[model samples]
Target: MPIQVGDKIPDVTVMTMTAEGPKPVKTSELFAGKKVALFSVPGAFTPTCSAKHLPGFVEKASDIRGKGVDEIVCIAVNDAFVMGAWGKSANAEGKVTMIGDGNGDLTKALGLEMDGSGFGLGMRGQRFSMIVDDGKVTHLNVEAPGAFEVSSAEYMLNQL
Candidate 1:
Protein backbone atom coordinates (compact mmCIF):
# COMPACT_ATOMS: atom_id res chain seq x y z
CA MET A 1 0.00 0.00 0.00
CA PRO A 2 1.02 3.62 -0.45
CA ILE A 3 2.47 5.50 2.46
CA GLN A 4 -0.03 7.28 4.67
CA VAL A 5 -0.35 9.64 7.59
CA GLY A 6 1.15 8.25 10.79
CA ASP A 7 3.61 6.11 8.84
CA LYS A 8 7.32 6.81 9.01
CA ILE A 9 8.89 7.66 5.69
CA PRO A 10 10.75 4.68 4.35
CA ASP A 11 14.50 4.48 4.73
CA VAL A 12 15.94 4.57 1.23
CA THR A 13 18.75 6.22 -0.62
CA VAL A 14 17.91 9.22 -2.74
CA MET A 15 20.27 11.62 -4.50
CA THR A 16 20.76 15.33 -4.09
CA MET A 17 23.08 17.62 -6.00
CA THR A 18 25.82 19.40 -4.11
CA ALA A 19 28.83 21.54 -4.88
CA GLU A 20 30.96 18.44 -4.93
CA GLY A 21 28.54 16.27 -6.90
CA PRO A 22 25.51 14.13 -6.52
CA LYS A 23 25.28 12.77 -2.99
CA PRO A 24 23.18 10.11 -1.36
CA VAL A 25 20.78 10.91 1.44
CA LYS A 26 19.01 8.51 3.70
CA THR A 27 15.33 9.32 4.15
CA SER A 28 15.43 8.34 7.80
CA GLU A 29 18.09 10.94 8.54
CA LEU A 30 16.64 13.62 6.28
CA PHE A 31 13.21 13.52 7.88
CA ALA A 32 14.37 12.99 11.43
CA GLY A 33 13.89 15.81 13.92
CA LYS A 34 12.17 18.13 11.49
CA LYS A 35 8.85 18.90 9.88
CA VAL A 36 9.37 18.53 6.14
CA ALA A 37 7.12 19.59 3.30
CA LEU A 38 7.77 17.20 0.41
CA PHE A 39 6.26 17.02 -3.04
CA SER A 40 6.95 14.73 -5.98
CA VAL A 41 6.75 15.19 -9.70
CA PRO A 42 6.55 12.36 -12.20
CA GLY A 43 9.63 13.57 -13.99
CA ALA A 44 11.67 16.73 -14.12
CA PHE A 45 11.02 19.47 -16.64
CA THR A 46 7.72 18.15 -17.96
CA PRO A 47 5.09 20.71 -18.97
CA THR A 48 2.81 20.64 -15.95
CA CYS A 49 5.70 19.98 -13.61
CA SER A 50 7.74 22.96 -14.79
CA ALA A 51 4.92 25.36 -15.39
CA LYS A 52 2.90 24.65 -12.26
CA HIS A 53 4.06 22.00 -9.81
CA LEU A 54 7.61 22.93 -8.83
CA PRO A 55 7.12 26.65 -9.26
CA GLY A 56 4.24 26.74 -6.83
CA PHE A 57 6.49 25.49 -4.07
CA VAL A 58 9.24 27.86 -5.09
CA GLU A 59 6.89 30.82 -4.98
CA LYS A 60 5.25 29.98 -1.69
CA ALA A 61 8.31 28.53 0.01
CA SER A 62 8.71 31.16 2.68
CA ASP A 63 5.02 31.22 3.46
CA ILE A 64 5.02 27.49 3.84
CA ARG A 65 8.17 27.51 5.93
CA GLY A 66 6.76 30.16 8.20
CA LYS A 67 4.12 27.68 9.27
CA GLY A 68 6.70 25.65 11.24
CA VAL A 69 7.92 23.48 8.39
CA ASP A 70 11.63 23.01 8.79
CA GLU A 71 12.27 22.35 5.13
CA ILE A 72 10.64 22.00 1.72
CA VAL A 73 11.69 19.20 -0.62
CA CYS A 74 10.96 18.44 -4.24
CA ILE A 75 11.52 14.98 -5.66
CA ALA A 76 11.35 13.53 -9.14
CA VAL A 77 12.13 10.25 -10.81
CA ASN A 78 15.08 11.60 -12.71
CA ASP A 79 18.82 11.65 -12.38
CA ALA A 80 20.58 14.00 -9.98
CA PHE A 81 22.06 16.12 -12.74
CA VAL A 82 18.67 16.75 -14.30
CA MET A 83 17.17 17.53 -10.92
CA GLY A 84 20.01 19.93 -10.14
CA ALA A 85 19.57 21.74 -13.42
CA TRP A 86 15.82 21.96 -12.96
CA GLY A 87 16.22 23.40 -9.48
CA LYS A 88 18.65 26.02 -10.75
CA SER A 89 16.38 26.94 -13.62
CA ALA A 90 13.40 27.22 -11.29
CA ASN A 91 15.39 29.29 -8.76
CA ALA A 92 14.70 26.73 -6.06
CA GLU A 93 18.08 27.19 -4.45
CA GLY A 94 17.86 27.46 -0.66
CA LYS A 95 14.08 27.59 -0.92
CA VAL A 96 13.51 23.97 -1.82
CA THR A 97 15.58 20.85 -1.62
CA MET A 98 15.75 18.88 -4.88
CA ILE A 99 15.94 15.14 -4.55
CA GLY A 100 16.48 12.63 -7.35
CA ASP A 101 14.97 9.21 -7.14
CA GLY A 102 16.92 8.07 -10.15
CA ASN A 103 16.26 4.42 -9.58
CA GLY A 104 12.84 4.97 -8.08
CA ASP A 105 14.05 3.42 -4.87
CA LEU A 106 12.28 5.86 -2.59
CA THR A 107 9.22 5.97 -4.81
CA LYS A 108 8.86 2.23 -4.82
CA ALA A 109 9.43 2.10 -1.10
CA LEU A 110 6.54 4.46 -0.61
CA GLY A 111 4.37 2.45 -3.05
CA LEU A 112 3.89 5.58 -5.13
CA GLU A 113 5.38 4.39 -8.37
CA MET A 114 3.42 4.87 -11.58
CA ASP A 115 4.05 3.69 -15.08
CA GLY A 116 4.38 6.25 -17.81
CA SER A 117 5.36 4.02 -20.65
CA GLY A 118 2.73 5.50 -22.93
CA PHE A 119 4.57 8.78 -22.71
CA GLY A 120 7.92 7.06 -22.95
CA LEU A 121 8.70 8.16 -19.41
CA GLY A 122 8.72 4.63 -18.07
CA MET A 123 8.32 4.24 -14.33
CA ARG A 124 7.86 7.36 -12.23
CA GLY A 125 6.37 8.68 -9.04
CA GLN A 126 2.83 9.95 -8.97
CA ARG A 127 2.13 13.59 -8.19
CA PHE A 128 1.87 13.87 -4.44
CA SER A 129 2.84 15.91 -1.41
CA MET A 130 3.17 15.14 2.23
CA ILE A 131 4.04 16.65 5.57
CA VAL A 132 6.58 14.60 7.44
CA ASP A 133 7.25 15.51 11.02
CA ASP A 134 10.35 14.01 12.57
CA GLY A 135 10.13 11.10 10.15
CA LYS A 136 6.46 10.33 10.68
CA VAL A 137 3.98 11.42 8.03
CA THR A 138 1.28 13.76 9.32
CA HIS A 139 -0.47 14.62 6.07
CA LEU A 140 -0.55 13.22 2.55
CA ASN A 141 -2.13 14.67 -0.57
CA VAL A 142 -1.91 12.47 -3.60
CA GLU A 143 -3.30 13.75 -6.85
CA ALA A 144 -5.33 11.57 -9.12
CA PRO A 145 -3.85 10.76 -12.50
CA GLY A 146 -4.07 13.78 -14.81
CA ALA A 147 -5.25 15.92 -11.94
CA PHE A 148 -3.48 18.83 -10.26
CA GLU A 149 -5.61 20.07 -7.42
CA VAL A 150 -4.63 18.65 -4.05
CA SER A 151 -0.88 18.40 -4.48
CA SER A 152 -0.43 22.08 -5.21
CA ALA A 153 1.51 24.23 -2.78
CA GLU A 154 -1.56 26.28 -2.01
CA TYR A 155 -3.39 23.20 -0.84
CA MET A 156 -0.48 22.13 1.27
CA LEU A 157 -0.25 25.57 2.84
CA ASN A 158 -3.92 25.55 3.74
CA GLN A 159 -3.38 22.30 5.60
CA LEU A 160 -0.56 23.83 7.61
Candidate 2:
Protein backbone atom coordinates (compact mmCIF):
# COMPACT_ATOMS: atom_id res chain seq x y z
CA MET A 1 0.00 0.00 0.00
CA PRO A 2 1.03 3.58 -0.52
CA ILE A 3 2.10 5.72 2.37
CA GLN A 4 -1.00 7.53 3.58
CA VAL A 5 -1.85 10.51 5.69
CA GLY A 6 -1.18 9.78 9.34
CA ASP A 7 1.41 7.16 8.50
CA LYS A 8 4.43 7.77 10.67
CA ILE A 9 7.08 8.10 8.07
CA PRO A 10 9.48 5.23 8.46
CA ASP A 11 12.96 6.11 9.59
CA VAL A 12 15.29 6.00 6.64
CA THR A 13 18.78 7.24 6.02
CA VAL A 14 19.24 9.99 3.46
CA MET A 15 22.41 11.78 2.45
CA THR A 16 22.35 15.55 2.47
CA MET A 17 25.04 18.04 1.69
CA THR A 18 26.70 19.27 4.85
CA ALA A 19 29.56 21.65 5.54
CA GLU A 20 32.03 18.80 5.50
CA GLY A 21 30.40 16.46 2.97
CA PRO A 22 27.27 14.41 2.48
CA LYS A 23 25.83 13.80 5.91
CA PRO A 24 23.28 11.16 6.81
CA VAL A 25 19.90 12.42 7.96
CA LYS A 26 17.57 10.01 9.63
CA THR A 27 13.99 10.33 8.38
CA SER A 28 12.39 10.23 11.79
CA GLU A 29 14.81 12.85 13.00
CA LEU A 30 13.73 15.13 10.20
CA PHE A 31 10.16 15.19 11.47
CA ALA A 32 10.81 14.03 14.99
CA GLY A 33 9.89 17.28 16.68
CA LYS A 34 9.13 19.66 13.86
CA LYS A 35 6.73 20.65 11.14
CA VAL A 36 8.25 20.19 7.73
CA ALA A 37 7.32 20.62 4.11
CA LEU A 38 8.86 17.94 1.90
CA PHE A 39 8.80 17.79 -1.85
CA SER A 40 10.34 15.25 -4.20
CA VAL A 41 11.52 15.65 -7.74
CA PRO A 42 12.39 13.24 -10.53
CA GLY A 43 15.97 14.39 -10.61
CA ALA A 44 18.13 17.34 -9.71
CA PHE A 45 18.00 19.52 -12.81
CA THR A 46 15.11 18.27 -14.87
CA PRO A 47 12.93 20.81 -16.71
CA THR A 48 9.74 21.09 -14.71
CA CYS A 49 11.57 20.38 -11.48
CA SER A 50 14.00 23.22 -12.04
CA ALA A 51 11.62 25.66 -13.66
CA LYS A 52 8.69 25.26 -11.31
CA HIS A 53 8.79 22.71 -8.49
CA LEU A 54 11.97 23.76 -6.70
CA PRO A 55 11.63 27.46 -7.36
CA GLY A 56 8.20 27.43 -5.78
CA PHE A 57 9.64 26.40 -2.43
CA VAL A 58 12.59 28.75 -2.78
CA GLU A 59 10.30 31.71 -3.38
CA LYS A 60 7.94 30.68 -0.62
CA ALA A 61 10.55 29.69 1.95
CA SER A 62 9.69 32.69 4.08
CA ASP A 63 5.97 32.08 3.86
CA ILE A 64 6.38 28.43 4.68
CA ARG A 65 8.49 29.31 7.68
CA GLY A 66 5.87 31.78 8.82
CA LYS A 67 3.35 28.98 8.69
CA GLY A 68 5.38 27.05 11.27
CA VAL A 69 7.39 24.87 9.02
CA ASP A 70 10.77 24.25 10.57
CA GLU A 71 12.29 22.83 7.46
CA ILE A 72 11.63 22.65 3.75
CA VAL A 73 13.10 19.38 2.46
CA CYS A 74 13.69 18.50 -1.15
CA ILE A 75 14.32 14.88 -2.13
CA ALA A 76 15.71 13.58 -5.36
CA VAL A 77 16.77 10.11 -6.48
CA ASN A 78 20.26 11.37 -7.02
CA ASP A 79 23.69 11.20 -5.44
CA ALA A 80 24.90 13.74 -2.93
CA PHE A 81 27.28 15.27 -5.41
CA VAL A 82 24.51 15.94 -7.91
CA MET A 83 22.13 17.16 -5.24
CA GLY A 84 24.74 19.47 -3.81
CA ALA A 85 25.67 20.85 -7.17
CA TRP A 86 22.04 21.26 -8.09
CA GLY A 87 21.26 23.05 -4.87
CA LYS A 88 24.15 25.42 -5.44
CA SER A 89 23.22 25.82 -9.06
CA ALA A 90 19.63 26.54 -8.11
CA ASN A 91 20.63 28.88 -5.28
CA ALA A 92 19.01 26.61 -2.71
CA GLU A 93 21.63 26.97 0.00
CA GLY A 94 20.15 27.92 3.39
CA LYS A 95 16.65 28.14 1.94
CA VAL A 96 16.06 24.39 1.70
CA THR A 97 17.54 21.03 2.58
CA MET A 98 18.34 19.01 -0.46
CA ILE A 99 18.29 15.28 0.30
CA GLY A 100 19.76 12.53 -1.81
CA ASP A 101 18.06 9.16 -1.90
CA GLY A 102 20.81 7.56 -3.88
CA ASN A 103 19.73 4.05 -3.01
CA GLY A 104 15.96 4.46 -3.54
CA ASP A 105 15.10 3.05 -0.12
CA LEU A 106 12.88 5.91 0.95
CA THR A 107 11.13 6.12 -2.39
CA LYS A 108 10.44 2.43 -2.29
CA ALA A 109 9.07 2.64 1.21
CA LEU A 110 6.73 5.40 0.09
CA GLY A 111 5.74 3.61 -3.13
CA LEU A 112 6.49 6.70 -5.22
CA GLU A 113 9.33 5.50 -7.35
CA MET A 114 9.18 6.02 -11.10
CA ASP A 115 11.11 4.57 -14.01
CA GLY A 116 12.41 7.25 -16.34
CA SER A 117 14.79 5.23 -18.39
CA GLY A 118 12.94 6.16 -21.55
CA PHE A 119 13.63 9.76 -20.74
CA GLY A 120 17.26 8.75 -20.37
CA LEU A 121 17.10 9.15 -16.63
CA GLY A 122 17.25 5.96 -14.64
CA MET A 123 14.96 5.23 -11.72
CA ARG A 124 13.53 8.45 -10.30
CA GLY A 125 11.00 9.69 -7.81
CA GLN A 126 7.46 10.76 -8.54
CA ARG A 127 6.85 14.41 -7.87
CA PHE A 128 4.89 15.04 -4.72
CA SER A 129 4.70 17.26 -1.64
CA MET A 130 3.51 16.74 1.89
CA ILE A 131 3.27 18.47 5.23
CA VAL A 132 4.74 16.42 8.02
CA ASP A 133 4.12 17.36 11.61
CA ASP A 134 5.69 15.48 14.46
CA GLY A 135 6.72 12.71 12.11
CA LYS A 136 3.24 12.03 10.79
CA VAL A 137 1.90 13.22 7.51
CA THR A 138 -0.90 15.71 8.00
CA HIS A 139 -1.42 16.89 4.45
CA LEU A 140 -0.27 15.36 1.20
CA ASN A 141 -0.25 16.60 -2.38
CA VAL A 142 0.53 13.84 -4.83
CA GLU A 143 0.97 15.04 -8.36
CA ALA A 144 -0.53 13.06 -11.19
CA PRO A 145 1.88 11.39 -13.54
CA GLY A 146 3.35 14.16 -15.68
CA ALA A 147 1.38 16.87 -13.87
CA PHE A 148 2.74 19.72 -11.79
CA GLU A 149 -0.10 22.04 -10.84
CA VAL A 150 -1.25 20.88 -7.42
CA SER A 151 2.14 20.22 -5.87
CA SER A 152 3.47 23.74 -6.20
CA ALA A 153 4.46 25.70 -3.12
CA GLU A 154 1.65 28.22 -3.65
CA TYR A 155 -0.91 25.44 -3.40
CA MET A 156 0.74 23.86 -0.36
CA LEU A 157 0.99 27.25 1.30
CA ASN A 158 -2.76 27.67 0.98
CA GLN A 159 -3.17 24.37 2.79
CA LEU A 160 -1.18 25.67 5.72
Candidate 3:
Protein backbone atom coordinates (compact mmCIF):
# COMPACT_ATOMS: atom_id res chain seq x y z
CA MET A 1 0.00 0.00 0.00
CA PRO A 2 1.08 3.53 -0.58
CA ILE A 3 2.31 5.33 2.47
CA GLN A 4 -0.52 7.28 4.07
CA VAL A 5 -0.76 10.24 6.34
CA GLY A 6 -0.86 8.12 9.48
CA ASP A 7 1.25 5.15 8.48
CA LYS A 8 4.32 4.21 10.47
CA ILE A 9 7.33 4.84 8.32
CA PRO A 10 8.87 1.64 7.05
CA ASP A 11 12.28 0.84 8.45
CA VAL A 12 14.70 0.09 5.66
CA THR A 13 18.46 0.37 5.42
CA VAL A 14 20.39 2.37 2.85
CA MET A 15 23.93 3.58 2.38
CA THR A 16 23.96 7.32 2.42
CA MET A 17 26.91 9.38 1.35
CA THR A 18 28.98 10.83 4.15
CA ALA A 19 32.18 12.81 4.43
CA GLU A 20 34.22 9.65 4.78
CA GLY A 21 32.20 7.36 2.56
CA PRO A 22 28.90 5.53 2.37
CA LYS A 23 27.19 5.35 5.76
CA PRO A 24 24.30 3.21 6.83
CA VAL A 25 21.03 4.82 7.84
CA LYS A 26 17.80 3.14 8.79
CA THR A 27 14.52 4.73 7.76
CA SER A 28 12.83 4.40 11.12
CA GLU A 29 15.86 5.71 12.99
CA LEU A 30 15.96 8.72 10.70
CA PHE A 31 12.64 9.96 11.98
CA ALA A 32 12.78 8.64 15.49
CA GLY A 33 11.92 11.18 18.14
CA LYS A 34 11.95 14.04 15.70
CA LYS A 35 10.01 15.99 13.15
CA VAL A 36 11.55 15.18 9.76
CA ALA A 37 10.99 16.81 6.42
CA LEU A 38 11.80 14.23 3.77
CA PHE A 39 11.69 14.99 0.07
CA SER A 40 12.47 12.93 -3.00
CA VAL A 41 13.36 13.97 -6.51
CA PRO A 42 13.63 12.31 -9.91
CA GLY A 43 17.40 12.60 -10.07
CA ALA A 44 20.32 14.62 -8.90
CA PHE A 45 21.03 17.83 -10.80
CA THR A 46 17.98 17.53 -12.99
CA PRO A 47 16.54 20.78 -14.23
CA THR A 48 13.62 21.16 -11.90
CA CYS A 49 15.34 19.41 -9.05
CA SER A 50 18.38 21.68 -9.07
CA ALA A 51 16.71 25.02 -9.68
CA LYS A 52 13.56 24.85 -7.59
CA HIS A 53 12.92 21.65 -5.69
CA LEU A 54 16.09 21.24 -3.63
CA PRO A 55 17.01 24.87 -3.50
CA GLY A 56 13.63 25.61 -1.98
CA PHE A 57 14.37 23.17 0.78
CA VAL A 58 17.83 24.59 1.36
CA GLU A 59 16.51 28.13 1.39
CA LYS A 60 13.89 27.24 3.94
CA ALA A 61 15.77 24.66 5.95
CA SER A 62 16.16 26.97 8.94
CA ASP A 63 12.50 27.98 9.01
CA ILE A 64 11.41 24.39 8.54
CA ARG A 65 13.52 23.43 11.52
CA GLY A 66 12.17 26.42 13.36
CA LYS A 67 8.71 25.01 12.75
CA GLY A 68 9.72 22.03 14.89
CA VAL A 69 11.50 19.87 12.39
CA ASP A 70 14.70 18.17 13.48
CA GLU A 71 16.03 16.83 10.22
CA ILE A 72 15.66 17.62 6.53
CA VAL A 73 16.31 14.68 4.22
CA CYS A 74 16.68 14.80 0.45
CA ILE A 75 16.60 11.33 -1.09
CA ALA A 76 17.20 10.13 -4.62
CA VAL A 77 17.83 6.92 -6.56
CA ASN A 78 21.39 7.89 -7.36
CA ASP A 79 24.38 6.28 -5.70
CA ALA A 80 26.29 7.75 -2.79
CA PHE A 81 28.96 9.41 -4.91
CA VAL A 82 26.51 11.13 -7.21
CA MET A 83 24.26 12.13 -4.32
CA GLY A 84 27.17 13.57 -2.41
CA ALA A 85 28.40 15.52 -5.40
CA TRP A 86 24.92 16.79 -6.12
CA GLY A 87 24.45 17.92 -2.55
CA LYS A 88 27.67 19.88 -2.75
CA SER A 89 26.71 21.37 -6.11
CA ALA A 90 23.33 22.34 -4.71
CA ASN A 91 24.98 23.98 -1.72
CA ALA A 92 23.06 21.78 0.75
CA GLU A 93 25.86 19.74 2.27
CA GLY A 94 25.02 20.75 5.82
CA LYS A 95 21.43 21.91 5.48
CA VAL A 96 20.00 18.61 4.23
CA THR A 97 20.77 14.95 4.64
CA MET A 98 21.24 13.39 1.21
CA ILE A 99 20.36 9.72 1.24
CA GLY A 100 21.35 7.55 -1.71
CA ASP A 101 18.91 4.87 -2.75
CA GLY A 102 21.09 3.30 -5.45
CA ASN A 103 18.80 0.35 -6.09
CA GLY A 104 15.51 2.21 -5.83
CA ASP A 105 14.44 -0.10 -3.01
CA LEU A 106 13.61 2.73 -0.69
CA THR A 107 11.69 4.70 -3.31
CA LYS A 108 9.76 1.62 -4.38
CA ALA A 109 8.99 0.79 -0.78
CA LEU A 110 7.53 4.25 -0.44
CA GLY A 111 5.44 3.73 -3.62
CA LEU A 112 6.94 6.72 -5.36
CA GLU A 113 8.72 5.23 -8.34
CA MET A 114 8.50 6.94 -11.73
CA ASP A 115 9.75 5.36 -14.94
CA GLY A 116 11.64 7.77 -17.12
CA SER A 117 13.09 5.61 -19.88
CA GLY A 118 11.27 7.54 -22.53
CA PHE A 119 13.26 10.50 -21.39
CA GLY A 120 16.25 8.18 -21.21
CA LEU A 121 16.48 8.75 -17.50
CA GLY A 122 15.79 5.17 -16.46
CA MET A 123 14.30 4.50 -13.01
CA ARG A 124 13.49 7.60 -11.06
CA GLY A 125 11.55 8.72 -8.04
CA GLN A 126 8.41 10.80 -8.11
CA ARG A 127 8.65 14.26 -6.72
CA PHE A 128 7.13 14.42 -3.26
CA SER A 129 7.59 15.59 0.29
CA MET A 130 6.40 14.48 3.67
CA ILE A 131 6.29 15.74 7.21
CA VAL A 132 6.97 12.81 9.47
CA ASP A 133 6.56 13.28 13.21
CA ASP A 134 8.17 10.75 15.51
CA GLY A 135 8.23 8.05 12.81
CA LYS A 136 4.62 8.49 11.69
CA VAL A 137 3.84 10.35 8.55
CA THR A 138 1.71 13.35 9.55
CA HIS A 139 1.55 15.06 6.19
CA LEU A 140 2.07 14.02 2.57
CA ASN A 141 2.37 16.17 -0.54
CA VAL A 142 2.75 14.34 -3.82
CA GLU A 143 3.13 16.36 -6.97
CA ALA A 144 1.30 15.68 -10.17
CA PRO A 145 3.22 14.83 -13.34
CA GLY A 146 4.94 17.95 -14.67
CA ALA A 147 3.67 19.85 -11.67
CA PHE A 148 5.17 21.01 -8.42
CA GLU A 149 2.18 21.45 -6.16
CA VAL A 150 2.37 20.01 -2.69
CA SER A 151 6.15 19.47 -2.59
CA SER A 152 7.58 22.91 -2.15
CA ALA A 153 9.19 24.02 1.09
CA GLU A 154 7.12 27.20 1.14
CA TYR A 155 3.88 25.24 0.85
CA MET A 156 4.90 22.91 3.66
CA LEU A 157 5.91 25.84 5.79
CA ASN A 158 2.40 27.22 5.46
CA GLN A 159 0.95 23.89 6.51
CA LEU A 160 3.26 23.74 9.52
What are the Cα lDDT values of the candidates? Answer: 0.96, 0.91, 0.90
lDDT accuracy of residue 66 in candidate 1? 96
Worst 10 residues of 1 by lDDT: 2-11
In terms of lDDT, model 1 sits at 0.96
Ranking by TM-score: 1, 2, 3
Model 2, residue 145: distance off in Å is 1.0
Task: Tell me model 2's lDDT, rounded to 2 decimals.
Answer: 0.91
| Model number with the top TM-score | 1
Model 2 residue 63 CA deviation (Å) reads: 0.6
- Which is better, 2 or 3, measured by lDDT? 2
Error of 3 at 34 (Å): 1.0
Writing each residue's lDDT as its tens digit, candidate 3 over 27-120 gives 8788899999999999998999999999999999999999989999999989988888989998997799899988888888888899989899
Question: Model 2: runs farther than 4 Å from truth?
Answer: none
Better of 2 and 3 by TM-score: 2
Candidate 1 backbone collisions, by pair: none
Instruction: Tell me the deviation in Å of residue 141 in model 2.
Output: 0.9
Clashes of each: 0, 0, 0
Where does model 3 exceed 4 Å of error? Answer: none
Would you list the clashing residue pairs of candidate 2?
none
